[model samples]
Target: MLVLGIDTSCDDTSVSVYDAKENRVLSNIVSSQYSFHREFGGVVPEIAARKHAENIDLVFEEALEVAGVGVKDLNLISVTNRPGLLPALLVGLTFGKGLAYSLSVPFKAVHHIEAHIFSPFIGSEPEYPFIALVVSGGHTLIVLVEGFGSYSLLGKTLDDAVGEAYDKVAKLLGLGYPGGPVIDRLYREYDGKYLELPKPKVKGFNYSFSGIKTAVRRLVEKGYPAEQVAASFQETAVSYLIGKLKKALKETGVRRVAVSGGVSANSLLRERLKELDVDLYLPPLEYTSDNGAMVAYVGYRRFLIEGEDTLEVGALARCPIS
Candidate 1:
């Protein structure tokens, strides 16, 4: 089947065409709003929504053109509908619904996070019942995936997510917006051993980045080299994540592990996961962050079993896959 996916959840406008028969993405396009939000040191929801309004059509056209298919040729339409800025979600969902209706084809609303969870499956072998660590700007979660749409929440952050902490700390150090990339770059430039930060002592498989964020704030006030501070913070955050992932593996004894989400693009996280003795599936750098290809893949999978969503399906601010 051929599916077109749309994602305007947050600051990125992404669209893709997936050909399930070939198990490949025909075209995946993502227009980042990072440059627009950089001055504000974070995403401005109003600005994000407006940008999506401007770029959605252009992105859709580009995706379809690159995929070498017209809208009439598509068998299904999928769009992210929940757990995002309401205005942003509305833009994509409305466009998707309109397109599906005009084409007289089945369309489905996909959960943004669920799309992240299944992202690694695009063009890769199917590995079911694996542990997934999905760390991103808005969320940090570890889930046990048994199959498509079947997820068990293993652990999640108690307060600020890992990516949120990264942005806040970058602001404290006068780093630009979308701090995860900046900090990851700095981690390679400086030696982090000089500035030691305590890892949070949270119990079980859950995560807690708030304490680490607070500690970074204090360290910034005390005066430390920005590069060292950035490096240290990145290391500590990755360590915390790796600790929980290890615990999850031991507890559940799942030999397969996959990491997804925006933060999953971190260089350190990938390098660290490589050392672990298990079957690892890490989406390519492009798919690690938000993208439409993953959404399309999940949509096609869901449509096979559940069929299309009713036009009444509304966007959700926050929803869990479980």
Candidate 2:
């Protein structure tokens, strides 16, 4: 069955078509509003919401065009409905509802984080009973996935997310807008061993980046080399992430591991995680962020795993897939 997914969880407006039986993405399109929010140093809710209201149609149209199918051809309609910026979410929900009603198809509301956990299956087959680390701009979470839509939270941030840490450090160093990639590139120029950044010694499957964020600032002001400081900052941040991730794996006893969200797009993170010698999955470069394709794919799997949901499914600004 064909499921159409719509996503406007934050700065990107995206649409995707997925085939439940085949477990594949027929077409996925994303319209990014990064440039509009770049100068502001972060996303502005009002501007992002307004842009999503305008771009949803164009993004959906492109999805159909790329998939070689129209709205009428879809068997189910789905949109992200929770755990996102409220203003950004309403646009996708409103558009998705209208399309579902007009086409008389079942409408499903999927959680944003759930969609991220399921994103790896966008192009490949899925593996069950694994650990999924969801690291993005606003969230950092570890989930022990037992099956489709069946997961238990293993760990999460006590304060700022990993992505936010990267961004903050980047801004301090005069780097570009999404901080992780730039910090990573600049890290190659410095020695990570130089700075003695604090590592949040949180015990057992929990994470804390608040101290690291503060420590980086103090180190920079104390005459640390710019390049080495950048390198140490990234290393410490990733070290904390990897530390908790490994802890989650041990606690859950699941070697099959995967990660998703905008920060997962980082080259260094991917490289580090790949060395684990476990069955691992990462989204295609396009699926690493908030894209409609992941939503559609999640919707497709949901319908099959839990059966078809009524079009009366409620819209939520916060929801739990489990």
Candidate 3:
């Protein structure tokens, strides 16, 4: 079946078409709002919603055109409806519902994080009962995945997420908006031996990055070079992630591991994962961030079982995976 997926969960307006039978994505289009929100240092919910409204139709047209399929050919429509900005989620949800209603097709609502967890399966499938580490701007969690729609959240961030920490640190160092990519690039330019950032000692599977972020502030105030600070920060942050993931692997005894979300695209993270001595699944860089393909794939899976959602289904600001 051909499924159309829309994601307006955050600062990206995305649309994609997936072919369930072929296990292939026909088209995936993402219009980033980074340039729009850069001046503000972070996403402005209202502006993100408006951008989605303006681009959703054009994105839809692009997706259909790229897929070489018309609206009537779509068997189902799916959209991210929860765990994101309320207004942004509504833009995609409303558009998806309208399309489904007009096309007389089944409509499904997908969780944004769930889509992240399923990202690794976009191009290749993995065996069941694998560990999923979802690290992104808004969320960080280690989940135990038993099967489709079956997830056990093992640990999550107690405060700010890793990506948020990156952005905050970048801002404190006078770096530009969307800190992850910038810091990741700059950190490689210089070895970070000048600064020693604190790694959070928080116990259990849960994570805490607020302390690390503060450490960056203090070190920067001490007149450390921004490049060295960025490098030190990235190393410490990624180390925390690796430590937590190792703990999860030890506890769960799951040999197969998959990582998703924007931060999963980090070179350091991928390099560390490769040395873990297990079957590792990492999504291509395109699927690492917020994109319509991940949502479309997850939606296609759900549509095969539960089918359509009622018209009453609405958007939500915060929805957790149980």
Which prediction has more favorable lDDT, 2 or 3? 3
Give the TM-scores of the predictions, in the order they appear.
0.98, 0.93, 0.98
Clashing pairs in 3: none
Instruction: Give the clash total for candidate 1.
Output: 0
Ranking by TM-score: 3, 1, 2
Candidate 2, superposed: residue stretches over 4 Å from native:
189-193, 223-225, 307-315, 320-322
**Mind giving the per-residue lDDT tens digits that candidate 2 earns over 22-100?**
8778988889997898787778899999999988888889899999987789999889888778899889988998888
In candidate 1, what are the lDDT values of residues 1-322, reduced to their tens digit? 8999999999999999999888899999999999999999988989999999999999999999999998899989999998999999999999999999999999999999999988877886567889989998899999999987789998899899899999999999999999999899999888547577877777677888888888898998889889988998988899889988999999998999988998999999999999999999888999988899999998998898998998888999899768
**Clash totals for all candidate models:** 0, 0, 0
Compared with the true structure, the alpha-carbon lDDT of candidate 3 equals 0.91
Give every collision pair in model 1.
none
User: For model 3, how does the per-residue alpha-carbon lDDT over 1-322 read when each residue is reduced to its tens digit?
Assistant: 8989899999999999998889899999999989998888889999999999999999999999999998889998989998999999999999999989998888999999999999988966769999999999999999999998889989999999999998899899889789999999986788537466777777689999999998888988999888888998988899889999999999889998999999999998899999998889999998999999999898888877887789789888998899
Residue 112 in candidate 1 has what lDDT?
92
